[model samples]
Target: MNVRTHILRRNNTGGIFHQRGVAALLLVLLVGISATVVTLGTMSYVRGSQKSQLTVHGQTQAEINAWSGAEALGQYLNGIEVETVTTAMDDIVFSRDNQTIASAQYKPDCSQTSRDLYCFDVNGISAGHNSNLEVVYQIPIIRDVSYTEISNPIVIKGDTEVTGGGMAYLSSDSIDGFAVDGNLTITNATKSIASGCATGNIHVNGGGVEDNGHLYSSNGDITLEGLNLVGADIWGGNINVLAGSGFHFKSIKAVKNLKVTNAGNFKSDFIHANAVSFALEGQLGETLVHSDIAFGNGKSHLDYLEAGGNLIFHQDDQSHVPEFTRNSKIAGKILLRTGEDGNTLSTHYNSTFKNIEQGRTATDPGVPEWPECNVDATPFDVNTLISQANYIFYIDESDKPMLKIQNVKRASDDKSIDATINLSSEGGMNTAYLHNKPFFQCEWDSKSCITSKSNSTDGWVFEGVTHFPPGVILFAGKGNPNQRNLAPMNFTLASKSEKVGPLLNTILVTGDITLGRGGGRKEIHAPYFSSPDAVCDGDFYPANLCDKSSGSWQFEGKWDGDRVERNYPVANTSIMVNHTMTSEGWSLEGSVIVGDTFKTDSNLTNVHGVVVIGLNSDEGGMKITQGGIVVDFMDLDSNFLNIPTGNTQVTDESTLGIPTAMWARYY
Candidate 1:
């Protein structure tokens, strides 16, 4: 019985041990499984974090690339010529690591906001990331003049003196300032003057100065008396404002003394001078006076004042009476220093001062520099135009004195042709006639015309037989007499057309161009002699018939003679003369460029276009005698002629693609 019981106990113990071992094994397997799951989860998390970081880097890179492309395009536009900027605004690609990373293109129709503004759009790509950027910039107007360094585009090499009630009206655009190398004095009562820049003194007595532009004097004084000076900045050596003048200026800077007396209704933004003496009634802005200040009897309003010397308030006779009632007010600070004899700031009755500061060292206000004049003798070469000409005619001693052009074939292949020909003259009656057909028989002395083909052979003819091709006409006189050729002959163009048509012709003469002097009245209607359509007409030269009753030749009761007219709206007519261009009782339309003098005498003359005088000599300028001359530039277009590449003057306001505004987005 004991042996059987012991065997049962052994079997039970073995079974319990087997069960414990199996349980331990199962616990080990569970621990292993949990560790494996944790490892896999950690790996997955790491991978995901790396991917997110790479995406962010790519997005940032794309944005940077887009910004860089925009900048690059701006730089390119800044370096290239302004005329080519529009063409360069096409699609432009940027590459990195031998791959195209970004592209830039111009945004069209954006100029409607402002003609000076330009817009650009850019796109960048990096590692499947895209970015877009838009940039905007502003540009300024570009002006082309004869000299790049000259501040004034219209230059008279010598003095311009108009005296004795002569009516001389000079005007120009703001960009094209007028200049005289020598003195400029206008003593007429009916003068309407614009802005002027001079190397010498500028004196004006009795006239109206327009609010056109600024006046700059390099080394001389500027004096104004008995006139109305309006809205102009005067910078010069000295400025003198006398009695009976109405003054309104933005700023006045004088190197020497600035004297003002009886300046009625005076106003200025800023005034700087070495010595200032004012006895005026007006408002003044910031003023910097280097020397002593003499403020006389006047009611003045001042903004800021800085005086290097003694500031005194006295009467017109320089007597400092305490009872002198001078009401003056200051809005800002007053800076002053003690002058001779320990004399400092002095105030009159009813005078007000603000933030007065004394016992300070005075500062020197430097002088303003003068503008340079570097004009070229010839801005363009006449010989260079030869290759571009379609018809070349050389008139020398062999050609007839009276050359007639009739029934010539018009060039139909091209829009325009350039004619380089010479017109001959002899016996003081030498005339050149360019006519299309027989249209009118006009009497010069009577200023009357009869539209009859029977009498057309005797007088100027204007039948519609043919038309002169539209082109640039050049008239070159014989070479210089002292050199080898004969004396320069005057270019006289007499045109008789039945019907005046749309004319597009630029006439360039090497010598003199005379009108309204001979027995017959001269007329020029170009692009052709005459046409039946009658598209153009002038003062004396009518479109269909030369009827004096219908057209009044008298202009301002002064001019009554021949007429050179281009009725076309476009600026297709121009006249350039190397020497004198004289017009008597004549009216013209187009640009006039004279190398020497432009003269008008005993008649009224009206000109529409740019007038550039004194291109060859410093002795002669403009001479107008007993007549009125009016030149209006606003009637002509700016692109009438091509500006030379070397003579272009760009203003400070123009900058190439400055990138004023920018916007960016990423996808």
Candidate 2:
């Protein structure tokens, strides 16, 4: 009976259980779906984070690569030859992987003004896993280019037109071989081709009319309109420029005539010529015309005519030769070859004939013989030669004879005699440099010598030579000046101090010549000399004057010359020796004494600008001749003068408002 009732209930129970099972299955499915969703979300987040990290790393690497590329470019730029453009890649490198990151556009046109000199700009596109990067590199443009690398032979040729702006650098050790095949038109106002050579030539092409420095020629020629030449050896083969132009050269050796048809400015020495036969129509400043400069007038304007050598007088168009009849200060001999015409001396200006063969001074009115002066004459003592010295001159007589003199006095303080010299046919030497020996033998002439002490019994005193006034002398010969053996104007001996240079050859004195000095001061003896007629034969060698000699005289006075050499053997140069005074703050004229204060006047005013040079002076005080002319101003020694307060007292008490533990106290 129970089994039958249970069967009925089982059917009902099974229905209910099946329903519950279905609900449970639905719940299980829902939970599984939620779990899967969470897992997918987490996986997506991890993958995104991983991609982002890779992207950041790649970007950083790209930036680093870009910086490296920039450095590499800089190195390449640095390695480029100073005057020559890089033909091929010297050492241009790029990272292989980062190469696609950027690209650069080079501007080969020198006339174009492009902002390609800056850094490379990077444009990044995608920031995710698969990112695309773009890098833009800039090309370098040179401005105010400097040559800092080793140089090579660089020839800038052709009708290479620089229309806009371009710059070229030829640094030391670098030579620029500029060849203008065609008309090289450089219209760029700012364009410059600065050539700096260590030991090479900048052979420019002929017919290359430039608007600036060194216009045209295989050999250097000043054909430019407005160019400043700073070359050591300026061989003006054919220098043709506009009138009233500026031609500034350091050392000019012109083989041909320098004709300034219009007004021109020549501010340098014109040397090494048998005769300067040219029609000068310009303003000449410090015109040092060497040899017999045959000058004629053809609408020519001469500023200053300085004859350092013998001057020849000849008519340009069969006219009477104009001669200088006044007190002409001629350095060398004078020859007037009228050329079968009448000899008439005329002076455009008041010129002085120092060593005159036949000059107009009322006494010597006509021309003298070949040996007008003495030759093979007796050697005069230094003291005798210095006194009554009206003029000093040297003549060339040696036939290929090199005049060589040793142990001779080049300068002297006492002036008791005058000197005249003529070179001998066998060739003579007149060297003023004293090696280990004295410059001259100083024998006190009883009557001429001054006593050093107050007692009349004191022996005759040998006055040490003082400073010599600055003056330029020119020497001339009947024939070729270069062919004749001539001596340098001045020479000096080596000094004892290491700071002093070797025996000085040339010294430019910028002061006045005085006899005596102040009280208690010995004659500032610095031996020097002058010989007018020491020979009358052939020729001799003349050493360079004003060269930097070891034991040379100190240039304490203001120096003014056409040019000033500041290096050994005249390597470096300065245009002028800057000096100043009260009225002449920075004048080209003025007598400057050595060891002078070069300060302000007693009126509390600044004096002239004087340059003081010393070989060795531990005390920093120079001994000046007592009565020597010196220019000083109040402000000159202001830097060294210290005004002490009268109330100030020295104390060493630690607590008494004074510094204690002071060492190295003298008193």
Candidate 3:
């Protein structure tokens, strides 16, 4: 029984040992499964991190490529030859290693208030990622001198009559034309009128007319009496060729009638007239007459004559016969309107008629409509100048000091006055005067009060004087226009000293401006005026003064005193006058816009720049009585004029575009 108990105890212990072994095995399997799950989780996290890093790098590369594309577009725009962005453009690509990294396109947005603004869109692709960037830019607008009415050398709103002994030569290198709103009469003087348009009659009496251009008398006749007309195409209502007149014309078109009486050497390439009458002797080339034609008395030569009505050959004397060349063709019926002898008519028909057909067709070149006048005389009121003026001066006869000066603050950071005006009195004549004592310094030796400052912060300086750095001087006369007793503001610049008078730029005068004394020694010297940013030291004028290789700024003025020889460059200064501008033998430079007549009595030595006449009034024109003036028109740069703000259109082909503003953004 003891042995049996021992065996059961042993079996029990063995069973307990087996159960512990099973628990150990189960613990080992649990550890292995936990390790496998942790390893799999770690592997998945590592793969996800690597994929996220690649995606971030691709996006960064795409953004960089977009910026690069924007830069490339900017470079392309800078390299293009066109001045302004006219239309939407595309197809600009940035590529490397034969792979396109980005593409850019230019899109113009003209609907905005700023007209010249544009935008560029850049799309970048790198490593399967894409990005977009938009860049905005603004372009500056540059105006040209051709857009202004001052481009013409002469603009006259009223009658222009050259009636002196000396010749009046009108020519321009830029436009070679003149505009006259009224009658253009050149009598007793030799005048060379360029391509011109006259609203009234054009009468050339005893003067020579040589223009290699067209002349149109829009509403009246063209009378050439005792003159030589050469190289001109004339269009008028009636062309009357009086006695002893010679014509070498390209073409002549008369709407009403063309009469030639005892005219010598009438030659034209083509002639069209409603009714033509030739008496005495004349020569005519290819002519088309809409109505009747009468050839009387003298031997006449006609080539290719086409008449809509009858072609009459009248013989007052039996000996005189109207002869024509074999090239002559008559499209109308030949009739002896006022000849008693039928035998003379038969002889003339046999000698003159080459081809006479009643039903032959003739092309009528219709009369050209009158050319529009290029004179844009928009009245520039003095009040407008006053509103924009930095300094205003009023001259009154009643005040103790005749001159009153007023300074206006145009900007917050305005600089001190850096300009001067010289006033001098010579031989009881008050030549120059400016009121302010601080701005005027007297030179005791020359008896002249020189107005000048020591330094200037802005504007251009010439011969120790600053002009229009950012200032404009206005001279107003406190006088009534209707009352002759109360004198209007008349500023006469008569210099008896060696130095010039007040050299002012961009001046507005409400009164008349008399340049120089009659037969006096006063001379004016001015340099080429430009903007403050202009580099005047190149091939241009004021720069050419320092260049010894270039000749002196040609001054052909005959100064009366010790000839003050200085560089007189072509000035771009503006002188606006409300009344007549009388030049009494003075040498003047710069542009002058006159509201009244530009009258010259003595010899005008040298007159440079453009002269706009009859701006405010239609009663006055250019009247040169004695002196022979030469107006050398210089094209002023666009920077001198006021540029209006807004969306700028590409109006001129010579415009220059500059990128003013730029911004970029990523999308």
Candidate 4:
């Protein structure tokens, strides 16, 4: 019985051990499953975090790229034409190393005629986007005028007939050509019509009435009092020659009607009129006259007449317009109605219409549409540009100031600049100030160091500036008083033509520039014994010192570092006679501009470069007494604006320092 109990105990013990081992195994399995689930969750979290970081980085890069594109666009659009941008531009792609990434679109607001509005849209990596874009406007401030293409003869607008018995004379001092932007009327029998003239059709938006360029106008009745038709053509409206007024030269045509009463000595190949009425002793030319209404009531003869309406040559009881031979001994040819048949022509006193040519009266050479004026394509207003300069000067206003230019340069592809500046008023150390005394060094009888002891300008060197950016306007002041006849001031040019072109020497005078008087009245009395204003008020210098012969500017261009090469003053070598230049000499080598008048009545004026007249000081604009003005018109081919835009490079900005505006207008 003892042996059996022991065996049972051992068996029981073995069963217990087995049960404990199974429990341990189960626990280990549970722990292992929990660890696996936690690891899997952690791995998933890490991946999600990485994705979020990557997205943030991409958004930052896109924002940077969008701004970079905006910077580049500002430069590219500068100096670009409005029409070109409107046509060729769409969506713009921004690039890095030529690899395009960001894209931007442009929308222009063409509402304001004077300016443009630009808008841009850029998509970024981030969810945010911009609809409002920065706007930049490129504006030009001024432009020079161009004179080309001469009009044909018989150009008449309104009643452009000068009829006076006092006789009109053709003077060499007359303007070569005159363009009026509005209606023109010269009823002065003593008035001499010298040059060809043009007028605008409409009298409003395009109307800027000026007797400018000796010959250019826009619209209105160009009536005449005493007609002196030289080699000129009158273009405008109605033409009327009342009572005994005569045309001695070439062509008189009108878009309206031409009425001639006792006119004299008019010779031409062509004359077009809406209606022509001639009475009494009117001398006709060996030319063609086309009119809507043709009537020669008194003794007005016509060579070849083309009348659109009734044609009548009534003398006493006879009623029919007459025609004559081409080589007739009379002053003019016979009349032929433009719309009337040449076969139905008749004349008084048994005169015949047999000598006229049948083929010459086919179609009337029609006049150009009214206001046949041409406009320059430059993108700036001249008056506004001049007024906005950083430095503005009026020569001859206080005194004829001097200019000593150092240099001019194009600092970038879009900008041209000049760094060297030595204006006469701010004449630097060692430069000769000739405004007061060009003949002497320093002030008149003094040995002070205020001015250089020597009168030589050979060693004058330019001082270069690095900091000042390019394209900065430098306006010389207009001085204390407005620039009137610049009597006391005289300029001395140190010619550096090989170095600098005939440009205003870092100095520009805004007013009239009268160099010398006609006879001998040209002098500026400012002796150095007293204060500047006091001396001028004190009235120094010889009374006749301001004589026309004495008002010549001095030139020391060829100063060979020691002595001036010559004592005589050169007109246009190193000096540009700014503003209106009135002088006695016959030759002008450099550029000249007249704000009021360019009167060279002393002799014939020969201009090498540009000769522009903003205004005429004379009864007309310019009066060249004898030699007949000869202009090289080629002088107009260069960058006409002589304003000093300091020559300095702005490297970082792509604008080349050109002016730009954000144009406060928003989307």
Candidate 5:
């Protein structure tokens, strides 16, 4: 029974062992499956992390590249035009494939035209990016090359060549001439002579010589400067030159016309021409004339004849200038006259004075005529004639005293007054009257007192009051009073070639006029007049004078013995035009005509040209009848301000990058 139980147990034990082995195997399999699953999940997590990291890196690189491109584009745009950061940063892409990125231009929210806005972006790491781009950059678009064609004449500073047929010759360089219809200037060029055969004009200033040695201009004006014409003949319609302006003519023989203008205070010694007309405008410093001179068909005065040839002066038209004629000779006629007015004046041959009476004209019967009146030894000194006077004359309230006559003595040929007369006087009247004849009187007032004589007889006749006009005036003290004591007066001058009427006007200077009460109430015109009571007391020059008392100015008239005080010095109501004066450094008021030849310095840094033309409430403003011009001393072929803007683009060719341009404007 024991043996049977043992076998059964052994069998049971073997079965249990088998069962345990199976269970173990199944546990191992399940554990292995769970481990495999964990491993797979970890692997998957790691792969996803790597992919995200790669994408982030790519995006960062793209951002860096985009930012770098933005900076480069900003720097590039900096050189072209005014651009704002806000307007230069949008839509910016960084890609190696397209290699191009443009930032979105921003417009200011304020709608300001003067300002711009901008934005920026990256493209290399965008959603649709497909580039193997290590980096991408953006740069500004720069204009490198350009081409232009000018239909009209183009003036350049350096040199320009024209392949087409056109006239381009001036005083400076070579010219190519066709049917030239425009003005051509070739100044200061070396290899500039081309070919042009048109009727156009050309002005060459300074070219050595042409390879062909020929200059031709039909129906055109030609001027050459600084040139030596050895045997060259310039067949131009008209020509002009100055002696010192680099022009040397073997002999200027023209078939049309010639004009020579001298500016260096020198004269042209030789001039031989064959023209229907000739014009010579020059300043006669110290020149000798070898040809007969003719005057324009106008009134003129002949003073002397001392040239080598017979100085024949005649009147003719501009087309018939005698000096240009081949058979012209010298003839002489001279005359000299003395008087403020041209008519009723004393001629050199006559001594007696003549007066203008009615329409008929007659000379003084007592004076000599022609050759008899030529008294070379006669002594007539303007200064010594008025040195010893005897009259103490005072006008209204004038501090400056006029001549006073003491004792009158009639000589055989000239009248003389006693040499003892006091010239210094203030405001008071003469306490003791010594000589009170029917022609003399003395009066006194609060502001003025005068001692004078007034009569139609031989005595001093105080008539036609001396009035001070309202205008700019010059005052010269007692010493050397006649030099520039007054502004220039308008005087008619009749010259041989032209007759220029009164060119200027006179200004009145009041010495003792005072304004009414209250210190600042006095109104004084500056720069021209002096105020004896204001800041510049009626006296100007040497210092600014101030007027102490203010009172309305009044005019006063007085002669040798007749004195009238408290009268306003009224100006003559004659026909006189107003003046327009432009004040540069000084003030010039009132109405007056301005001469056309006014000068102003443009290069003077601190000097100002102040011109005041026309006055308020004046009858007429200053009239600019003719010219206000500036003619430079440069050669006719050279223009100071006619240079072209090279290529119409900025270039690094020169330091300034472009040729200087010349311009002129009228305001």
Candidate 6:
């Protein structure tokens, strides 16, 4: 505004104005730089978000496709005929919409040694993701392990070689494998194998020779010692390990005369012998045997020991017994297999025990009772079979009874009761297992009865005239054995009786057999039978014993063995029985049980087959004094015990436990 008029003054003002102008320009440049930085940062953020989403989606798709590849491989394997030789992949591809999505390499797992075992290992890839899966398809053979009754001894000798107990499971409760009633001698050096069947046992009678196996007489004091025993088990005759030797890994069990010689370093889970003798062995892992340690002289480690006869700490001569070393102690508990509270172990030494428990005689198979009867049993004569041999009855629980009887006298309360058999009076079956066809009675001409494809039909075996798929049997009783205060009901034959299983043909009892008991305070007497012969005419109180055209029964006691087909009886199985039992000359074939409290002064009576006694009772016990002898168990062909034919690993599903695409990885 002042123009050239104040030239001199303007010159001075011009310098200050120029400085302000320069400052304004610098501010504009800074604003432009800030705008450019904001725009670039926003663009970079958007681009990063897009890339993250794409990567996530792509990886997820890759995993899903990889699983798809696995499923495809599974289908192929399922369809192909399996061979022992593994099948390798030859550029096989899986696609969707004609676009390749997955590829897999499958290698079958087959055992040439085992004719019918197969499996598959699949390696799959999709996009960049990969997965590996294993699938089994077949089962193994039954002969991999078996135990037959052998007369000759089985001897194995070799340092490196092994007489495997055969390939089977190994555990405390049950094992699968074979057992020999005769002697099994494993001397030389090879380690013996243990039986692995749960329902099966391997017993040696001639005496287990651990001759590098064992050293004992045949049928004499049994000494369970397989030549080179690693985990094998032997249950022949009376067991005695008194050869002044030591055991490393062992479970010595015997029916009688069990003596351990403390001469070797012992290590194992148990020494469950009838006459178990050990001293000063603690549970360092499992108790190990030491040669220096003597019987009853020191501390001994044991899980459990149940003696049928007298539990002796030393042999008769006391030569095999050792003196206590280190400390006189019993590391674990020792159980006497009897219900007598006052029964004591004959220990003749001054020692200390941690725990010494008592085993009460009782049955613990909590099988439920029945509900009703469907059998149409007509009144008939109770005699006629007195001329035949003894009678055997297989009693089981049932929901539907096919035979009905009325007005029968009970053994315990001496009362008459009407009941139906094969019928349950309370609930349904514990297991809803229905056989495809009868085990016997081959439906006229059904080709599927003899042989089956496991899935197509129910496998069955029927011998003699006795039918397979027999209806479950029910005994009439009003007592619950589980409750000690509650009394049991009885269905007895005479004064002394027992129940023998497996009506080889058809067991016919010609006496009053009472069944179907509700609830009462009475003892249930379950008995096994003996060999019956023809009763003399004078023995028959009623003349027309066989001809019972009338309702009243004519015979006092008579059971016939005529309905049997093949003689297979189930043994050592948990059965339902009452508290009190009394019988002499009873030969129960199939299993073993011991320790009675009843003091019955009897004569020399020999017992064969499976004789189970002194179990599931806290009441008065029994003691069979004098001439009563308990023998070994031998029959196996006809029994309720079923051993799996194929390998234990196989299942009905056929895929083992592996999964296809529908499976989640278990890390």
lDDT per model, in order? 0.46, 0.24, 0.48, 0.32, 0.24, 0.26
Candidate 4 per-residue C-alpha lDDT over 593-639 given as tens digits, one digit per residue, 9 for 90 to 100: 44334444343445443344432222224433322344443323222
lDDT of 3: 0.48
Find the 10 residues in a row with the least total lDDT in model 1.
1-10
By TM-score, the best candidate is 3
lDDT comparison, 1 vs 6, better candidate: 1
**Model 2 TM-score, all chains together:** 0.21
Output the number of the lDDT-best candidate.
3
Residue pairs in steric clash, candidate 1?
437-463, 438-463, 439-462, 462-497, 462-498, 558-604, 559-604
Once superposed on the true structure, which residue ranges of model 4 sit more than 4 Å away at CA? 1-194, 200-217, 223-232, 241-250, 281-303, 317-321, 324-368, 375-475, 478-507, 510-587, 594-606, 615-667
For each of the candidates, give the backbone clash count: 7, 99, 3, 87, 86, 110
Error of 2 at 170 (Å): 7.6
Checking candidate 3 for backbone clashes, the offending pairs are 115-647, 420-451, 459-469
**Lowest summed lDDT over 10 consecutive residues: which window, candidate 5?**
1-10
Candidate number that wins on lDDT, 1 or 4: 1
lDDT at position 445, candidate 3 = 27
Q: Candidate 5 vs. truth: CA RMSD?
A: 40.9
What's the CA error at residue 667 for candidate 4, in Å?
Answer: 44
Give per-residue CA lDDT, model 2, range 28-73, as digits (tens): 1111111110111100111110001001112233332332333233
Query: Which ten contiguous residues of candidate 6 have the minimum total lDDT?
Result: 48-57
Task: Name the regions of candidate 1 deviating beyond 4 angstroms.
Answer: 1-153, 164-173, 279-282, 315-355, 371-471, 474-476, 479-487, 492-504, 517-573, 602-604, 626-628, 635-667
- Candidate 3: where is the Cα deviation over 4 Å? 1-151, 165-174, 316-331, 337-352, 359-368, 386-392, 396-415, 418-445, 448-473, 479-488, 496-507, 518-574, 634-667
Name the better of 4 and 5 by lDDT. Answer: 4
Candidate 5: stretches off by over 4 Å: 1-121, 124-211, 214-233, 239-667
lDDT of 6 by residue, 1-667 (tens): 0001110101212231111111211111111111110111100111110001000001234443433444445434432222212434544577766666566544343433243334444434445655543333332111111112221111111011112221111222221222222223323322222331111122332112221122223233444342233443333335554333345444443444345454344445444333344543323222222111124433344453332222233332333333232232232223222224423444343233323322323312121121111111111111211112121121223212122222122223222222222323342211112123222222222221222211112111111111222211222222221111121223232221112133221222211122111121112111222122111111111111111325533232222232111111211111223233333333333222222122222322222322322222222222333323333223222231221111122222221111112112211
- Give the poorly placed runs of model 6, Cα more than 4 Å off: 1-576, 587-600, 604-608, 614-624, 638-667
In candidate 5, position 79 carries an lDDT of 28
What TM-score does each of the candidates earn? 0.52, 0.21, 0.55, 0.38, 0.19, 0.21
